[model samples]
Target: MKTLLLLLFLLLLPIKTYSAVIEKIEIIGLKWTKEKFVRRELLFKEGDNFSKEKLKNSIRNLLNTHLFYKITPEVKEKDGKVTVVLKTKERFPIVPIPKFRAKTNRAFKTGIEIRDYNFRGMGNHIFLGLTKWFKNEHSERNFYINSMFYRIIKDRIDVGITLNFFNSYNNVFTKDNKVLGNYDLKSFKANVYMIEYLDLEKIRRLMLSFRPEINKYSNWIESTNQYYLSLGFTVDKTTDMVYYTEGSFYSFYIDFAEPNLSTVFTGSLIGTYSNSLKRGNINTLSFGGSVGTKIGYSGNGFLLDSGIPGYVSDKVKGKRFFNFKIFYRLALINKTVFIKPTIAGGDAFSNIPDNFLISPGFEVEAFWARLVDGIIRFKIFKGIGSGSDVQTSLKLGFRW
Candidate 1:
């Protein structure tokens, strides 16, 4: 009787195994999301292995879109087939954010930006904003609209289009720490770029960009219109969570401009590395630096840094910035409530080091998040050099 039972079990094993294979996938609560958009990020589809590990990975990929606040997946097994269902709680993708930034006794900018991270549920981003720059007496207003990240072809191609009309009152100071004057800077620009995503992970890409720009001195009668072409390559493998981030990123680019194509060339390299230990009291640490030079274009505003506090913002030829930061958990509300005493030095910007206007300051950062993954940061930073101010900035990080 034991041998007969064993024989019957062996014969049924293949039938049971086939029943475990995925036969269908169903998505729930994605009313605004296109099914293909979610499917492209999945690890398995119909007639494929439906392992728990693969389902978890698929959910992880879905989270990366930032479209949903939470995704709960269910795997159902019938007599002979497996069906997977993903129940997602979609976030309110359209958000209007108010912005404020300033240094002590310095100028400030106040604005409102409306961002749609999941435009039409296509996993694209679009934003338009207007800001007023306030100085002691002089002020200027700026407006911008951009679709800086749009996925065109599934896992293959992307595009960016942007327009900016900006007028700035840049405060110029004298060696005696007195207000020498302010430079009235006016400019308009439009950019269109395309990116070819090279791999399945979408972390590596080759980009081609075209930009037409107009730069001028409002006080002085100087203006120029230049067209530029650029090519760049990037590798970004980063994962970001509420309290921690882990990844490595690197990029390189070279540009050529038409006004002085022979001499007007520039190249840049930027990269960063971050790692976290989620098992202990300690949490995260990150460090990165960037250096770049322009072969020509030594005119005003070429470099947006003057190395002088409270001076005109754009007076440098190229860019240089670096930072070292560490994050420790203060409390646990959801995942982690706050990053207390989050300390960073060098380029004070968080996450991506895209800002190269180096103030060389140390940052005291405290931040809190919301249920839908919203973050508000209170940053108190002091400049390292002489004539530096005790700057205070309030930033709302839209986790779209």
Candidate 2:
């Protein structure tokens, strides 16, 4: 009786294990981007077992590339075999964009940039622009050029390279808003990075980067040349790179500056948590902070204008500093529009005032979901210090 039962169990196992296998992958829609590029983004291939989750993630990965306007995946099963069909609509490769920004009590800048998103149909990008700024009854100009190239190998290793160049004349200011000098600056920067996807869960990514930069600054007072080598590592578990509704990101880097300038170590942490409130409304809380210290003799440290609103870069210079900000965002229109209020405070430990600074600000933002996948933000800030004032800014930029 035992032998008969074993034979029956073995026979049923074959029937239960019979599942549909992917027979063919048909990609419909390729005007500029190649079929190989599209296939490389997919998570599954022919002869693999069909999974609905992988198919969904494959569509998401393709959309994340920002090259497609529309994507639809269809699975058809016939005679125990499955076929996957992907339909996509490509975006216009070349876009001529006009950029403008206005900051209260600071500068107003405008420029026209022409960007090619799908360079040679290989998911590369290149842009060139010329910008002019008007500030304090003086005019400054800058020329910018940038290029980014991305490649994926074996569905795991993600490689990218960025080249950037800038030439400009910038006004140097002291911490008390006094004009120190003006510098004619020319800089060239290049970065090479690789991201290794650890597993199919997509829960963790390891990032490694190396950047080399050279800057030449000339002024009536003196002339200086600075060279820097930066190495970075980051472990990211964030679900979204653009709109961070949840998860955390952490990064650490070390910079070595030549000519006895400064050797600095910096680290940052950012976290976001979201909850569903009443009536389909969502509330998100985000916090980010960074700390930096100089290891050697600090000649002149860079500005710490980030992590705190309402503070201009020219008014803040430090060698060792710590800054943090907390933000609360309420989705007013199903996450398409948000009312965000933030409170930020930070302190410099060296080379500046040793007092902590605080700023309270609010912003109204609209997310362009269909057209460009960007955000338009209008913000107002009030700084509470020994003697400070209110500032406002208008920003039009990409998300994340």
Candidate 3:
């Protein structure tokens, strides 16, 4: 009986094995196009025994490119083998040039600046800023003042105040508006930084200074907003004020201020850029421009005074400035210094705003101590079209 059963089992085993042989497999549905991005080839060889595990792996590899928004793989079998097909949707990659953002050491300690990423990823491009400075060498010698804020919605706010300082007045006006200006108890300022976002792929930002220097005028009572645009980095308030646009990979700005009753006509453009090279050296370029009238008073109006003589006065009577800069950010003994050669068109101004007038100068930022930074700059300005010339002036300041 045992021998008869063994013979039957052998006969049945051969029949079952033959039934398991795959005849054909079909694969279909691919997600990516043949152009632009190349797809990986199928790993399974023709006429080979199909393994489900091997087919599944091939589908997974294709999806890892991150270029696909969706991926689906299907397999079909006929007679003896199985075929696999992948259906995929390709995704476009959007590259973002990140901004190396920073804030004052005091801001970090006070927790005044709060955010996760320095470079916001919501819109195609955006810019935001907040800065405040205060100096209290001793209780007897107290000087407090310096603050500005620029944002692109849901970004940040900056406020500043000073107790002892030079006295300055702000005059306000508008189209069909009356002239009004005022002197602050000490020229203290406080403002909200609002940033506007556009659908453009390039960075856009605006900062407003609502210091109530023009108390008599209604428009001056509320702060006015200024715009700045750029492709990458920015550092310094003056650049944002005068030359708002220039440079290839740095900061850029555009300002639109009104004259009387919201009659916005005054505008300015500026930009700046810098690069780091081998041997602890750096290269930088900065330039900016604007075209407008030197009307009555307003924020930053002191700058618009072209200082040009007259019609043939060898000077344009509006605000105009241009600057070319090459600088290096160097490190020595655990400290850094930014040294640059600068050529400016309107460094203090002559009679006419022209290419003829040129000021050649150099600026230095020395980091002597970990907490002490010093800045000194000098320029020799010569007038163009005319022979008017001015002596070089030196600026000295300390930063903590």
Question: 2 or 3: which has the higher TM-score?
Answer: 2
Misplaced by over 4 Å in model 3 are 1-144, 147-191, 195-211, 215-323, 326-339, 346-355, 376-387, 398-400
**Whole-model Cα lDDT of every candidate shown, in order:** 0.64, 0.67, 0.36
Residues 1-400, candidate 1: write the lDDT tens digits.
9999999999878664433789889988876678989988887889986688778667766766667667888878987679998987776777787877774889887898888777878878788999986774557788999895556755668888999998766646354777655567788999999999786556788999999999886554457778878888888676544345456667777776666333555433344444444545435445444444444454423332223222133322235445455555444454544444444444322234544333433333333322333576555545444334556555665444
Among the numbered candidates, top lDDT falls to 2
Q: Write down the TM-score of every candidate.
A: 0.72, 0.73, 0.35
Off by over 4 Å in 2: 1-18, 29-32, 89-93, 101-108, 133-139, 152-222, 240-247, 262-288, 296-300, 303-306, 311-324, 331-336, 350-358, 387-389
Residue pairs in collision within model 2: none
RMSD of 1: 7.2
Give one digit per residue, the lDDT tens place, for model 2 in 50-101.
9898897787677667777678788899998999999988766676778787
Model 3 earns a TM-score of 0.35
What's the alpha carbon RMSD for model 2?
5.3
List, residue by residue over 173-275, the lDDT tens digit for candidate 3. 3345655554222232233333342311113334443332222223336543332222222332221101011223345555444444444555555454443
- Residue 309 local lDDT, model 1: 29
Predict model 3's lDDT versus the native.
Answer: 0.36
Checking candidate 1 for backbone clashes, the offending pairs are 303-316, 303-317
